[model samples]
Target: MDPALLKAREAFKKKAFATPVIEAKRPVTSNQESGKESNKKPRKSAPAPVAEKTFDFKKYKPSSNANFACLAKIVKYMKQRYLDGDNEPLTLEDMLDETNQLDLAPRQRQWLATEALKNNPKVDITEDGQKYFYKPTFPLKDKKSLLRLLDKYDQRGQGGIPLEDIQESLPNADRCIKALGEAIIMLTRPTDKKKILYYNDRSIQFKVDDEFQKFWRTAAVDGLDDAKIEEYLEKHGITSMKDVGGKNSTPMQKRKKPTSKKPRNFKKHNEHMGDILQDYNG
Candidate 1:
């Protein structure tokens, strides 16, 4: 470096840049100024947000609500069939008789019939003109439930109460029966057979299988329920729930829920790792 240039640079840096000062009329000591500042009221910070107390009012278990809606509609159709006559079920052509005003398309009718048959065994689908379903309405829902109800209200000699009265009381009768894959046997039939009548003498009954009842009773259980469910699995030749596929299914891969109060991943690291700063490239 040139001595003159270095000297000039140092001199320029050391040069004082001064401006005229205008002081306040009353000047106080550092302590007095600080004291005065301290005396002034401190600013109030924003109030902390009040957390809302959340309440869970939901009672129903998680289910396919859309499927339930469709089921309800199908149930309504079944009830209508029962009301019409406990004789021959409606034909494909006769399906839209009541709702003919809705002007349903062919595809729509097919879809509805398909859904109705899926959950309902009582619904019989056969092709005539178009592929149509025969949904016969039953007097009650599940065979066991119907049997119990009948036993409760049976008049012995007079058989059961009027069939119309039972039909009126049981709105979801046919749907329940269909869902359970059970049948209702007409205990009393007109001697004429061809003649349809809802006389007080008419009685109904169901044959609820023991195996089905046991299976249904233990349906809502984990695979770990070895006592009852294991027997069922063995009888049906089912090794795992994964083998049985349906709407309400048990997932094979069970993962633990992630929690907020833990260090994620592994915490421990290699002790002999070299200094990180030495390897810096980026």
Candidate 2:
């Protein structure tokens, strides 16, 4: 064999015998093991799921064939349910319980509210995101902002505010309520302890008495003016319409006017004819 061939063969044998070596890594220490575990972050235990409150259909389902007089009437009923001290949070299901459908889904309630109740002015049914709320009728268009001025124990559609308090909240609140008329009125509350101004006839005090109704009718007819309202209120002997029938008392009525007969046009017994003749001649 040639020298170059012999040299090549020797190189191939040496290259084949040569093996590559990899460096061995160091073993973890106790502290390093703890660090590893901490770094691994213990597969994050999944969060416990929250349970949703289920609606009670059998107990709370509305009347099947009942006909509400109007949307206002329906709102009135719903508001009374709240004010009656049964004041659970309202759901569209309760409002449309008139439909008699037990298996109403959330989306279905939304659709029903949008389609059936949204446009009606008699009642103020409102939706925020997916939640539905019953807003009271306000004379002003911004019901939400104006309503924020109120304090609610149960639900707040009706006004529990006093006249002076309301006046403080809104300068024209009286005029606004007057312009709104029966939409919001002064009435005894469900408790009947006080006469508070309410919006949309939401309280059980809705059953206005003869004198109470007469005052409002008279006020509306007399027109919306402080002077007229004061005079009319005074004429009715009504210091305050609040607690109108408290403790089984009759509602306030106007003070009776004194009666007296007018004098006759006939002449006096003596000298009347002669005096009249002389005066006519003069």
- Show how many residue pairs clash in every candidate, following the order shown: 0, 2
Q: Model 1 over residues 1-282: C-alpha lDDT tens digits? A: 999999998787667334455887886799999999999998999999999978543432324554456445655665565555443545544655643424544444454556544556546555453333435434454446565655554445435444444554454545643443432334444563432112222345467899999988986875555457657777898768644544555769988887677866976666456554364485
Query: Candidate 2, which segments miss by more than 4 Å at Cα?
Result: 1-73, 85-89, 98-111, 122-129, 138-282
Q: After superposition, how far is residue 25 of candidate 1 from its true place, in Å?
A: 76
lDDT (10s digit) by residue, model 2, range 177-221? 666556554766666456576544355555658998788777455
For each candidate in turn, the TM-score is 0.23, 0.21
Error of 2 at 62 (Å): 19
Q: Score each candidate by Cα lDDT.
A: 0.54, 0.54
Candidate 2, residue 223: lDDT:
50
Alpha-carbon error at 195 in model 2, in Å?
A: 14
Worst 10 residues of 1 by lDDT: 192-201
